[model samples]
Target: MDHQEMADVESQNLETPPDVFLKGKHQVTLKFDDVVYKIKTKKGGLLAKKRETVVKEILKGVTGVVEPGEMLAMLGPSGSGKTTLLTALGGRLGGKLHGSITYNGEAFSNDMKRNTGFVTQDDVLYPHLTVLETLVFTALLRLPKSVTKEKKVEHAKGVIDQLGLTMCKDSIVGSPYLRGVSGGERKRVSIAQELLINPSLLFLDEPTSGLDSTTAQRIVSTLWELACGGRTVVMTIHQPSSRLYYMFHKVLLLSEGNTLYFGKGSEAIEYFSNFGYAPSLAMNPSDFLLDLANGIYTDEFNADHTIDKQKLISVCKVNCVAQSKPALKGIYDSGKDQNRLQEKDSEKWPTNWGQQFLVLLRRDVKERRHESFSVLRVCQVLVVALISGLLWYKSDISHLQDQIGLLFFISGFWGFFPLFQAIFTFPQELTMLQKERSSGMYRLSSYFMSRVVADLPMELVLPTIFLFITYWMAGLKANVVNFMYTLLSLLLNVLTAQGLGLALGACVMDQKAATTLASVIMLCFLLAGGFYVQHVPNFIAWIKYISISYYTYQLFIGSQYSYGETYPCLTGQCSIVEFPSIKQIGVHFGLHDQLMAALGLLIMLIVYRLIAYIALMRIGVTKN
Candidate 1:
């Protein structure tokens, strides 16, 4: 059968009740008029002596509408403002936007946000997570607290079934390097995540860009069914096959930031034909439309017939002005209804603080479990621990220098390892975080706290294991109290270093730059850690005070030996308090005060994390 007939048969088989998911929810009617978006960009090369700021318009006076139970497909070539206009309609665009975009004759509000779903082209998913787990976590975080946990899971399963993902429900989402779900399945999973919220309006960016033709048809058909269920679905697409073209209820063609055509998909050919832009032979409607928008003429077109881009834009502008007047008037006439909407939209988050924290913490733990406990990471820690243990195996008291060096190595190893590992946490997850936060899944504070809390145990486990293996082999101390003190100090040091890494990652938001800065900072800490240079220059002496390694080394030394402990002197004579190792560690300068060293580390633990939290708050949720 042909595509249209195939689509007709499939639609008949796939039809369901309109209110299956959106029952009792508001049905949104999206309308935009005179929408224009511009950005300020610099116009000069890096080596140029001078640079100039220029305002570039991305969308120019574009207008259209998609009411309940209809789907609008935005079509254009690259740089035609298709994505920009879609973002504006979705209320996610920022920077010099001049337009009137309304939902159900009301301005965009928190309520509208709560009821809208935006699926980005890139599927921001945890590759290790099963499709079921992914959707369940989304439902738990985004659904209102009124729904019980069991009911939320049920809803997620329902969405999975609705989108034909039941077969892959237990499968991992996967990534480029890892084998998992197929590309089409991944796209549906993205759509399923948004559908968990039962949004009244859905916006997607090129939902079928990289898929095969059959998969693309299936995705578009699924969207058609969603629009059939009373949701306003709008998406940007490149050239689509004629079958998929006919699936959309409305088609909006854009060219160079201007609207080329808007109205019913079935009538688009007739509308364009009226302008004498019809193809002489059979052609995919989308192909023909794109050629006109891109100013490309096929062999089928008459050699003598020429089309002017500006003239087409002018005609579309006049047509848009005439078509948008009535819808714009209706929007202006609903001031009272808009006020009611504003009041109804007061709830900023669907779940309270505590609930958001618990749900997010659980999800974070599940998603990161493999990374934190992978065989490779565990083996790395074990190898390092074994090497350190064998190198420092049970030395005599006369070898005080070697023992102290081992302690310093312990401090330096942990201080470096955890910080480097933690630097990738924020930069890698920034995109996913922005997507979830923009959809109002939870508060940034809640997400931040849950993330830190979830990582605490995982971050500490390896270090604890390493220390247990290395401490006994090196015979540092046998007393339980002393061992506890050393372990506590090591854990605190790990946390402090990790906190610094988090701060750096959140501040820079770039993995390479953050790692580079972290390397420089860690090296400075190590050089001034009091083990390498006994007396740093007085001008820069304060560096040791803030160094996590400095405090940790002091704590390790104080825990391993007593203030008046004696060691066999190299010269066969020495005072108990004047031993070379004791003098080298500056025990006389209060370096043996374990309490003070621990307190310093404790302060850094709080301070660095506070800085990280502040940086995250500044990063905030991306609205543009």
Candidate 2:
């Protein structure tokens, strides 16, 4: 291709509407066949047992030629499968996906994520960062190297203005505990974050679901404006008001996994009327659409509940002309039909895994830095060290043994922190990450590595400072003995604990359950740490080896219990030199033996990370 020809192709690609996916010269189709889902238990065991399919064996097909620059609003009732159909189109649906969905003449892949942006119901904004930072970071992760930083900033600003968020541009986004922007503003910020890449297509799920009537209308208006700018927007809207109904240029109506109508909003009213229901002057169009869709509560609109199911069946029979059923019956037995992917041999896939991996890693690192939880953690750890160290103030060595227990408690407790944070934070963030992952923004490894890398600096620096302040203030050991020993203990605690966190985060889908599980595990480790309890009995003794705190404690106690050390023996009431006897029992190799006990804990960390990685990959980085 010549330079001008290539430029024209690039321009066409850049201008491709989000809704009107360009598929070759003019052929376009939105088809779905027997998209069925069966609910399973927490243990991967089928409870509904192929019975109670979340979505029945229904078929939906829409073949309307949506123009390149238009807004297609999918309006329906709650359980009418609007979101499900959208999920399917976005390439993020669950269950046995038997149908084929193609975009721009190619099936959606993880690689296409850079071109697609999905805005979810939940907003996963860092509470500490201003709006600009969040969007900038998102663009950094998803945009190409060709897009310059200045261009990136301009894009973010344009998205902000397009979304009508200029007033709150400099403000911090509000979260559960923090007070910053409003709900509607936060939602816009989420949209703005994805808009940085200037995606060809944008998929939004209930963008106005939680907001008030006015706010929802404003958001929809902004989306409409984006459509005017030549972006393709397909959103799932549930029960929109009469005033909000006119914003859509295109309307896709689905009922019970069946396509009722897929065309202009004006034609939708006529289509419903053909089935014997007319939109009343006083009635809301959205409510009318839903009433016909749900097959219930249509007295105000038409008093004809029978019209819904009848229309549904009629539409399904017409749209879903699937002559043959899916080759597989149950989802469990329907192993991934990856054979279809083999046809893509001719596609120019970016095969550079190494380059992609690096790109993903850098993006993840950026995200990790935005996590204020770790920053708060660093501050808290430092504060605790300073306050505790200064309070002890180089006092007598009377409380030496108790102090040793305290040291163990610190090491063990801090080690458990990452676990708590991941379980609580990760599941919640799963809402946002799931959207990004589905849209193909980045890889799982990139996210995992980025988070781990970002946390390393804070984790190492905080504990090291804590150890120094506490060691010197407690007047334990002064020379290199104190510095090296404490540093090593802190390092082990951080790594092992973070590994546990990742494992728990991946294992438990529910935040509450994961938190409870980690708490119990921490308590067990605390006991096995040999602080309050004397020794780990043979039956429970294995826990001592597995517990990270056990190793750090033993090392601290053995290292601190030296000849020149002056502290109270066991009872906590003795001067440094007044203790009966303070002696170092372990030589250099003995010290090695003591530290070696933590090897099990380190191994557990590795095992946990591996398991977490496997779990994340299997179900995907999104919610289970």
Q: Sum up the clashes in candidate 1.
A: 0
Judge candidate 2 at residue 319 and give its lDDT: 46
TM for candidate 2 is: 0.75
lDDT per prediction? 0.84, 0.64
Residues 317-395, model 2: lDDT tens digits: 5643322122212221332432122233232222233444565555445555656346677688778888878766674
Task: Show model 2 residue runs off by greater than 4 Å.
Answer: 1-55, 58-67, 110-112, 212-218, 225-231, 279-282, 296-308, 315-407, 416-425, 531-539, 562-591, 594-605, 622-624
Considering only N, C-alpha and C atoms within 3 Å, which residue pairs clash in candidate 1? none
TM-score, candidate 1, is: 0.94
Residue-wise C-alpha lDDT for candidate 1, range 1-624, written one tens digit per residue: 433345466445645556454556767778898898999999999998999999999998888878778889999999999998888888887779998888777788877788899999899999999999999999999999889999999999999999899999999999999899999999999999999888889999999989999999999989988888888899999989887887787899998998889887767777777877666777688988888888865545356344688988898878856786776677667644642234454567899999999988998898899898989999999999999999999875667878889988999999989899889999899889889988888888888899999898778899999999999998787779888888988999999999999999999998999999999999999988877887567899888888888888878877777765777876874554575445654654354476788899999888888998788777756531
